[model samples]
Structure formats: structure tokens, C-alpha cells
Target: MATAKTRQKILQTFLDLLSEHPYEDVSLPMIAAAAKVKLSDMRSAFASKLQLVAAFTEKIDTAVLDGVDEDMGDQPPRDRLFDVLMTRIDVLAAHKEAVRALHVAARHDPALALDFNRLEVRSQKWMLIAAGIDVSGVKATIVAQGLAVAFARVVGVWLEEDDEGMPRTMARLDKELDKGGSFMKRLNGLERAAKGVRSLLKRISDRPARRRPRADEDDGEPDLSDKAPAGA
Candidate 1:
């Protein structure tokens, strides 16, 4: 089996090249050459570009999530998300140029976007976990998708943002969080409404069906047999 060390080397090389060139131009041979690895070794580590992207994202996710802040646990959801996303930005700052290039390419490439979206949603699930937020069911799915979009937008800003401190990037992130808060409120309302509907339907379903009138009652005939039967 290829060691983790070798795989990481290959991924990092691809990221470096991706930053310096267009995504369409960055081929497997370029990555292999940049990584100083044989083509065979590079293939062993990553069979294709999509696999390379997925592995790159997984490594980045692990880097941020593996060391979460206990302090964040005591914070509000928005604040926690702010910290989580900002921490990710800090990691991303190193590859801002590459990420910027990828974002532009993905906008024009539907196939790339679709494959990347899968990885992005998966990454956001971990980010939610890091932020002490739930990541399950329909509402959680919405939240995850929203965060993925928010992060992508932030990366766009971060790429163009030249300051060492990234003041503009921070401002954009805050705005996105504000928007997310509003969206979540609406989502919560919808979820509550849906839950209520489900509960009502359950009650209606669980209630015993209305008893039908007996045949004698329906016919308006008394049980004369019973009246006449008592020890007669």
C-alpha cells in the first residue's frame, strides 16, 4: 500500500501547480513532475483528477477538524461557525491562488462543479460537527449546502483579498453568517410546520376509525329477539 506520506506529497504538488496554472492545463503528468514522483507512483496515489481533488479536500478537512476548539462549544451557533470557517480560511490562505483558480474553472465546468459539490457538502458536514451544530436530516442538509456556498463565496473574496489580515474577507464572512442566520430561522419555521403536519397526520391515522352502525340500528329495527329471549 502507498503510505500516507506519498499520497500527501502528490496532492500538495497538484495544488501547487493548480495555483500557478489553469485547471484545464494542469495534467497528471504535470502533477507527477512537480511532485518529483514517477507516473506509476502518482497513479498509485491518485488514479484521476477527481480523486486528487477529493483527497485534497479530505486532508484539508482533517487538518481543521482534528483540532477543534473546546472554547467554541460554549459559543452561539453563529459565533461557532465564524470560528470554524475562519479557521478554514486560515488554512486556505496558503492556497488562495490555487483555490481562486479552481473556483473560476468550476463556475464554467458543470462536471467539475458537480463532483466538487459532493466533496464540499461532505466537508461542510465536518465543519458543522466542529461548530457543535447538528448535521442530519432535511434541515441539516439545507444547512450543509448553505455553508458550502457561503464558504465558496468567502474563498472568492479571500483570493482577491491582498491584506495580510484579510479584513475584507472577514467582513464578507460575517455578512454570509448573518444571511445564514436568517435562512436558518426560515428553515426552522418550515421544519416546525412540517413536523406539526406530520404529528397531526399521525394523530388522525392513530385515532380509532368511527364505529359503523350495526345492521339492526341502520335499519331502525330494535333487537326484538333480545327483548323476547329472557327466559321466555
Candidate 2:
């Protein structure tokens, strides 16, 4: 078998083990044995357990992105995102138990959770792009991050969605997407407000300041302090 095939097998075996065993107890040797690859060759696939999980996420992300529907061009942004996210859920459905196991691990491991979210955000950026949404600049970053968080929540619902058709999961995703849309609208409003403030500040700064009057150039008003009784 090719090296790539062997490596993929190791990853799959690790996830399979993860589904059945605790992450802290799963061993590389176990993965190697289960994958039917020698420990020596398995070392070439993953140096640590976390690396195996990262590779799994990358593989799933690639699969979801490859399945993007170009026919969603005319749909609204939310619909486009809905379709792509559903496709992602489809790809994840097979690994539900493995994912549930990881979620349990993450809840107890802040460092691992943060690291995993880093990868998840990257995946969400591709999802945004695949959905025909803009993934550029600060706005793109904000949208992608919001989608990452929302997607995680949606996946949590998906893991328990025994209905096969996933109606409940779809409703949860729709609600989350609507929440994200509202947030994006607010963010855009803030951006617009910020731009307006910046323009106003620039205009103020560009206008020449009025020169302070020196001891010279007084008006024609009389010195009332000394001459106030002149008329009297």
C-alpha cells in the first residue's frame, strides 16, 4: 500500500479507537496494531495522538469542501451557508461517535479545545468561500469565526440527531445562522459608524485651527475698566 494509504488507515484506526476508548488511554501501538501497520511505519503517520485528530479534521474538511454545490450561486447567503454546512454535517455523520468522544475530551481540556478550534476556524473559512460568500479582510475573518462557533454548536445538535432526516438539527442550524446574520449586521453597522467617526475626525484635523490672538490686533472697543466713568 502507498504511504498515504497507510497513514490514512492509522488516522481512521485512531478515530475508531477514540470512539471506544478514552483519549488519554489510547496508545499509538494500539492504533498501529489495529491499522495492521508496523509501529515503525505508523510513527511516520503521526507522532502524537493530537496530530492524528488534526489530520482527521483536515480530511473531513477537504471532503466537505469538495462536495460544494456550484448551483447555489443564486441563493441567498444564508441558504448557501445552510447547504454547505449540511454537507459538512453529512460528512461528519459517519464519525458521530468519534466526534462525541472528542467533544467529551475537549470539555475537559481547554488547551486541546483551543487548538481544535484553530483548525475548525480554518475549515469554516473554506466553507464560507465554498458557499460563495466573501472571505476577505476583517469582515471575512469575523464571519468565518462566527460560522466556526455556530457550526460547532450545530454539530453538537447533530451528534444526537437520531431522526436520520435531522429536522431538529436543521432547525438549530437555521436559528444559529439567523443569530450570526444579526450579529454580522450589527458588526457592519459598527463598521459604518467607525468609518463615519474617522471621516469626521479627519475633517476636523484637516481644518486649519484658528490662530490665537496675541497682544496685538485688538478690536475698537474702549478700555472700560479705566474709562467706565468717562460718560458720568
Candidate 3:
């Protein structure tokens, strides 16, 4: 509908204004003026400033997700994860205003924060799947969730500084992944050791014990209760 287009235009205008000023300083009338739409027209599209901000955020999320899926197609797991993260960084850099607005709004909106958390989890799941890791178990799920949150924090730090560009962000990502690889290697070693210990115990328990002379026969006395000591 035409109303939809007008609403989108107003949101875009708001994003444009964000590039010029911080989100806290932006006003509805200023957004309307920038969009060249009347204040009443803007109100018709959104009931309130918060609603408008939410709509803008939804638009940006859609745009970023669309681009992410396209860039991630048919790649190897590690490549996919790297590309996905780099794409996110690039999208945020390109649409800094929209991203900044969402970041600002997330502080005040619990639902928005939840949405962001879910998005990160989804990304981590995809990466783990690509890596051929089984992400169904509780431990795997927790690792994925943790990694996603850590990655998001890294992206946030990158956004906070003007000098930390995409290449620098990508480098940081590589370093983080390297550290993750080391951690995973250590975890795998522990798992292997645990498995070995379990197997050893099973083998020992399953094997028949060597025959020995009864204690009564050796000492010419009846064995008491035929039971091993508590320590044994």
C-alpha cells in the first residue's frame, strides 16, 4: 500500500538523520521534515516514536539477514562463519546509523535485547552445524550461545570506535576463532581421556579375575563373611 511506502520513507529519513546526529537527539518532527512528509503523515504510519524506531530496526534486520544468507551460500563451515561475521560487520559499517539506532533502542527494550540474543544464537548454530559439530547436547548448545554472545560483543566494540574498520574487525574475528580452536582442541582431549578411562574401567570389570587360593585354605581358618574389606 502507499502507506507502507510512506512509512518506509519516514524510517529511512530517520536513519539518514542518525548519520548526522545521535539517536537521543533525533526528534519526530525532524524526521518528518527530513522525509519531506508531514508530521500527521508520519503519525499515520506509526503511533509513537518507539514504534517508528522499532520499525526501522526491523527493516535493518531484514536487510542484513537477506545479505547474510546470500553471502553464506554453499560455503565450508569455517568459511561460512567467517563470511557471515564479516558480512555483519560490513552491513553495520554501511548502515551505521540504523545499527546505532538499534543499539540505542536495545538498552531500553527487553524484547529487542531478546531478539538480538536469538539472532546471535542462530548464527552460532549455523556455524557449529557447518563445522560438523553436533549441537543438540546441552554442552554444545551452551558453547554456541556463549560464542554468539562473545562475537556480538566484539562487533559492538568494533562499532564503538571510528578507527576500527572492517578489515581490523575481520582480523580480530580471526584471532578469536583461533583461540576458540585452541579451546576446542583442549576440550576434545579431555573428552578423549574420559572415554579412555571409561573404556579401561569397563574392560577391567568385564575380565574374569585370576583364580586364587581361598583365605581359609591358606590360613586353615574360615573366611569371615567372605567379604572384602571396605577399602577393597
Candidate 4:
């Protein structure tokens, strides 16, 4: 549709400007002019620069999600993750310079860096799910955050890797994922232990309450045996 095209153009124009200039230096008006849309049109498409950046990220997420290979269901988790992440990088290849420029800006801007991390964490959740990884609870959030940080490192290598096959980037990703898999194993152990404790507590709390022993029916001892543990 026309609206979608305009939004895409605005985002592309912003990226093009970022490739040529610092992210801090690119303004909404400049993007509007470069995109050939009126100020109002640009506003209608995106409220601010950060939102535009988030939209661009969502675009990449969609591309990567859509491109997931169904046949990879039988692949090892790490291999599937590698395929998903590499697909992400390939989608991002067209705007490599823009990404590099944004990274430079983030390095100097704490706010931008934090914002970028938040977006990356969100996107990495989908990437994990695409790789058939469980993203269900607090542990899944930690995993996504860790993956986001690791993928950022891979992208750092990728930005400078010029070899046709990107050997360096691929190697870095493999190392990162290998490390991450070990971390996940440890984390899963802890999660299982925690779950066991919670289940035990739940079982203790759900036990039936015993009736108070009547004076006439007293068996010589107070019947406190069926009480749930304190704080259960």
C-alpha cells in the first residue's frame, strides 16, 4: 500500500543518511527531505528517530523470521541458531554502513546504547524462538539478553569483515554460541532446581488442614501435624 511504501521510504532514507553521516547528526527534517516526503507525511509514518530505528529493527526481524528454514527442525539448536542469526546478518548486509554508523553513535551515547540493547533483546527473543528454543520464563529473558549481547559482538566483527565468506564473523558467532550453550546448560540446571523447590513448597502448602482436637477427643498431644509450613 501507499502508506507502507512511504514508511519504508522514510526508514530507508534515514538509513541512507546514517550511512553518510553520524546518527546524532541525522534529523527528522533531513530524513523527510531525503525521503521526498512532506514533514507531515514523515510525522505520520514515524513520530521520532528512535521509533524509526525500532521500525527498521522490526523489518529485519520479519525478514529473518520469514526466511527461517523449516528443514532445520532436525538440526542441532546451535546450528539452527547460527542459521537464524546469519540470515539476520544477511538481511542487514544492505545497510551495513548504516549499522556501523549507529554503533559508533551508541558507543558515545549511553541512552542510545541502552535503547539499542532493549530493541536487540526483543528481536533476539524471536530469533531464539525461530531456532526452536524455549522462551517461556524469566530464564528465557536472560537468555535473550545474553544472545543480544553476543550477537552485537558478532555484528562488530561483521562490520569490519570484508572477506566474501565473512570467516571472521562466522568464527566469532560460533565461539559466542558455544559459550552461550554452556551458559544455558548451567542456567537450565539452576532453573530446574528452582522449579523443584517451588513444586515442593506448593505440595507442602496444598496439604489438607487437620481438625483441631476437641477437649473430649484429645489423644494427649496437640495436633499440629497437618499445618502448612510457615510462609508456605
Better of 2 and 3 by lDDT: 2
Pairs with steric clashes in candidate 1: none
For model 2, the superposed segments whose C-alpha errors exceed 4 Å read 38-40, 204-232
The C-alpha TM-scores of every prediction are: 0.88, 0.83, 0.52, 0.88
Tens-digit per-residue lDDT, 55-108, candidate 4: 989999999999999999999989999999999999999999999998898889
Candidate 1, residue 104: lDDT? 88
Which residue runs does candidate 1 get wrong by more than 4 Å? 211-232
The better candidate by lDDT, 3 or 4, is 4
Best by lDDT: 4
The residue-by-residue lDDT of candidate 2 on 4-53, one tens digit each, is 87887888888899889878778999888888988888777788887888
- Model 4 earns a TM-score of 0.88
Candidate 3 error regions (>4 Å): 48-50, 68-74, 101-148, 160-165, 175-232
In candidate 1, what residue range of length 10 has the lowest lDDT sum? Answer: 214-223
Candidate 3 residue lDDT tens string, 179-215: 7777767877887898899999999999999888785
Ranking the candidates on lDDT from highest down gives 4, 1, 2, 3
Clash pairs, model 4 backbone = none
**Full ranking by TM-score:** 1, 4, 2, 3
